[model samples]
Target: MSIKSALAKPFAKIIYKKVQKWANNPVDTQKKVFEELIAQGASTAFGQDHDFVSINNHSDFVKRVPVRDYEALKPYVERVVAGEPDVLWKGKPLYFAKTSGTTSGAKYIPLTKESMPNHVEAARNAILLYINETGNAKFVDGKMIFLQGSPELKEQNGIQLGRLSGIVAHYVPKYLQKNRMPSWETNCIDDWETKVDAVVEETLPENMTVISGIPSWVQMYFEKIQQKTGKAVGDVFKNFNLFIFGGVNYEPYRAKFENLIGRKVDSIELYPASEGFFAYQDKQNERGMLLLLNSGIFYEFIKADEFFTENPKRLTIKDVEVGVNYVMIISSNAGLWGYNLGDTIQFTSTKPYRVIVSGRIKHFISAFGEHVIGKEVEQAMQEATEGTDIRVSEFTVAPQITPEEGLPYHEWFIEFENEPQDFSALAKKLDNSLQKQNSYYYDLIVGKVLQPLKINSVKKGGFQAYMKSQGKLGGQNKIPRLSNDRKIVEGIPQ
Candidate 1:
């Protein structure tokens, strides 16, 4: 190893040791650490003064300050980019992590140097936990493709540099930096089409072994690479052993990925956000991803259905119940307190603090009065095609409103792996599967008052090409899996 890497190896080891200690600790002990962090964050105006004092010491203190969204911090971001110190906090922002808010198109989240350690620690914990579970320390060896966002900073505009992916990139251990696929310029989150092409050209020769990215982007890239070479991407990177997918579930593209690669890749699910790297797949293969409790964030869960209710019950690490869906709220070292991130999850076990991703809180279609969550849709899709020779390459469901009907109807666009022997039978089975699985959907199916579910098949590679056209390539970004409005879903052609 180079001297620099040799030096970093030990430093990385030290960090990993600290993370391993945290990961293997009891849930109660981790909870205590998070509680202390929340208390510290709430009591102090951290970025404002660049000082960590109790909230009581701050002058503009309200008894109970309400949670503020990205709009509340826009002025601070503008000032920070203008070279003003202490614009949001006391010191210059180390970087801005770009996030997509429900209301905001793109948001620049500020991060300071002090909080940078948390990002590193969270990632380290994820890697170390993988090693502990699989006994593989060479995970970083060979080529590891990170489906990343645009790394370029917005100089003169509203959104600035220092995206979450970029901020994390700035802090990656030096040893791993050399192995990151795609050039820094091409790894950007924006400008997806060009970046996708750039990554394909650069990484093709590295003899990559691990592919890590959002499922949709990866699927798109796989298709794009295949189209360019007239051969499958897996055929090119035949040595690829593991697929580390995060930001979204790979269930939709699971079989297709395996087929494209011509091998069963060891898959790892990572739960990370612009705010924090929260959970990772450590054991039980694909069962439940373990929460990184000690990595600078405290987590709270409320009943998924009760989220908007006035009196919703919250569950801490100590109080989590298995098998029930709960909405996730996070308090991070980055200064977000009691934040309802709007994602839902289910606890599979409290003993190991393992949980499964249920769905997004707001990503439901409630027009029919039957609340259909991401989990239910995912399960229904899996069941509808189970044991069938046909495979769904890509799919999306949207609630459409027709002038003839007051209520909305579901429109499904699915691409099958092969020409169905009986297309009508397949469609009928899909409708029945959905109705039987989801109550709200069942009502629509039985009533027949709404338009019947429509399924359309497009030519292969159509979805990937469409995604590239929209500039949403790579990392943490994908076509919306579920949307209340049909326009956005329909926008994803084929």
Candidate 2:
């Protein structure tokens, strides 16, 4: 092993033990984080306004602080942005993670001194855990690239503000600086397509071993490399073995990725957001990511089915069950309290507190009351296309409430890399898979309230054209797997 790989083995073990201490005591770990957060929050203006001093337990917290999304909490965030101290947390935030969401405008999530380390450490620990689990530290010795937003940041209220990945870029460990690919200038090239082209050129001659990014963007890179080198990515970088990805599920892109690489590469999934880094895949072979119970954030869950109803009951680590879709709520050291993350997750293992992000709570189709979630649709797609040569490039689902003829149906806009032999048969198989996963959808189809879902073939690059039109063409921007409204997919040609 190279010097770096040799050193990584022992270091990874230490992190594994540290992570295990919290994982083994999941409930207590979270409770302690909760207690510490409440204590710090008591000093903030929001805490004082919400009676945080009186809150001694989760029940008290629940009664005092109701869940609030960005809009509901905007007033306090506005104050913080205008340079107010002791407003949200104990002091002014160290930085603001600027994110694009909520119709109002950009959301500036606080990243305090106390909370920033968790973001850096959680990502570090994920790789360390992988090394410890599989004894695969050799990849650390080779050039690694994380396709991310520009490291360039802007100033806001004397605090740095930028994309989360950009902020995190400043923290890349010194040991890996030489190994990380795509020079700073290439990364700073604001245009994603241009940056990727630059990345392809910069990485082409290196001994690249690890590649990381959202799957869609990475696929673009892979295609670019293939076009220039006229070789499978594996041939271009024979040592490349690990693909670390986040922001979306990888299964849908698995076949296409394997095809691009010309072989399967091990992958690690992470659940990260502008608010906080929550979970990461800790094992080479596992169903879900290891939730960071001992991180600065404390988690809460409410069943997705009842999330829209009056006062949905919140459950802590002690109460969640496997396989149930629950909307994830969080309180964190970043000074966000009772914050609705709007992401739905399902616990795959409660003992070690592992979770898989199922979907965004808002990104689902229930116009016909079937409540088909991202997870269900993804699962259906995976099952339907299994054991087939059909490869999907990108896809999204929207309800077609009005059709030119016949009953209205759910429209699936698919950009296929390799189309199936029979589109009609594929549609039936997809419908069957979805029916097996959701009874309400099954009932709707049986009742003839909705016709069988129809698949619309989107010509190659159609989705890319649509995303580029919206100015969301890369770097953590991805079309939703499904939407309640047709706004997102409306621009797509079908």
Candidate 3:
């Protein structure tokens, strides 16, 4: 091992001990974070609005603050965007982690001076814990590549705004700067395909040992390397041993990746979002990522099935049980109050609090774990027929898990008031629109794991007929806009 890896080994041990102290007392650690959040919140506009001064404990908090999605939280976020200070948290956010939303065009999640370190530290600790456990730090000395968005940031008022990964690029620990690749110029390339091309050019000859990104994008990188060198990626970068990824499960693409690399390498899974860096894989052999209890975020859980029900029971960490699906809610120091994070997760272990991402709370199709949600399909459908005379009558989308021909696809059963001039062109529009909105779907499409979506023209009254058959069809009942399986689609009149 070189000097950097040699030094990281001892440092890794110190981090492990510190992490264990909190992990072992999960509930108490969460309580401390909650108290800190409430104490700090008492000084803010939101705290005054919600009567946070009267909140004595968890029960009081739940009563004072109801759960809210981005739309509900927009009022405060708007005030912050307009240069207001202390509207949500103690002060104006240092940066806004911009993300795409369903109803809202763009969302600006706050990163306060206090909460920003949680994201960077959680990522670093994940690697260090691995080093401490396996006695493997050799990868630290070689080149590391994080495939991500353009680091170019825009300023609003006095606060910087960018994609979470782009904002994170500015905060890469000083120690890793020498090992990290490709150059900043390549990282700032805006277009995905163009950036991948530039990254390959810069990284091909380096002593690359660690690669990080969403699995689909990283697969693109692997494929590009093979095309250039006509060799497996592992052979091309003999020292590459670590694959760090988040956002989507790697299982569906594992075989394809291993085939591309010619061998399996150690992998670490992280559960991160624009809202917060929530969890990371602390143990290699573990079933789930360890929930971050001490990261200045207090978490709540509501049973997924009951989330739509009025006044569903909100659960604290101590009340969470293994194997039950729950919508993870959070109140963080970042100024978000009782925010609905849109993720559904199942706890795998309660003692140290570990969870596996299950799916989104409402209208999600994850047959291949791509997490195609209702909003994405709606946006795509709207975009596809925006200026065209062709109008939609009724429609629903479902995953085609096993097609008789080649790879799988999202099957669109659409009833058109006026059909497209060319059916194939319309399908392409739908496919392109969906891919543009969702990065995971884009990756799947480009990686050849899923084909471009296919649209089946439904008989004009098909949706109504299906809805009638299923129920006492009336004003209240309607055809689901999207389903993961073909149950609803199969029943539609052909």
Displacement of the residue 483 alpha carbon in candidate 1, Å:
1.6
Q: Model 3: clashing residue pairs? A: none
Pairwise TM-score winner, candidates 1 and 3:
1
- Model 1 earns a TM-score of 0.82
Query: What is the model-wide C-alpha lDDT for candidate 2?
Result: 0.92
- Which wins on lDDT, candidate 2 or candidate 3? 2
State the local distance difference test value for candidate 3: 0.85
lDDT of 2 by residue, 261-304 (tens): 99988888998998999999998777999998888999999999
Q: Answer with 1 or 2, whichever has the higher TM-score.
A: 2
Q: State the lDDT of candidate 3 residue by residue for 178-282, as single tens digits.
A: 888979999887756677888999999999999998775686688789999999999999999999998766653565677789899999999888788999999
For every model shown, what is its TM-score relative to the native structure? 0.82, 0.99, 0.77
The candidate maximizing lDDT is: 2
Q: Pick the candidate with the highest TM-score.
A: 2
Clashing residue pairs for model 2 = none
Q: Which ten residues in a row have the lowest lDDT in candidate 3?
A: 471-480
RMSD of 1: 4.7
Supply every candidate's count of residue pairs whose N, Cα or C atoms clash at under 3 angstroms: 12, 0, 0
lDDT of 3 at 255: 54
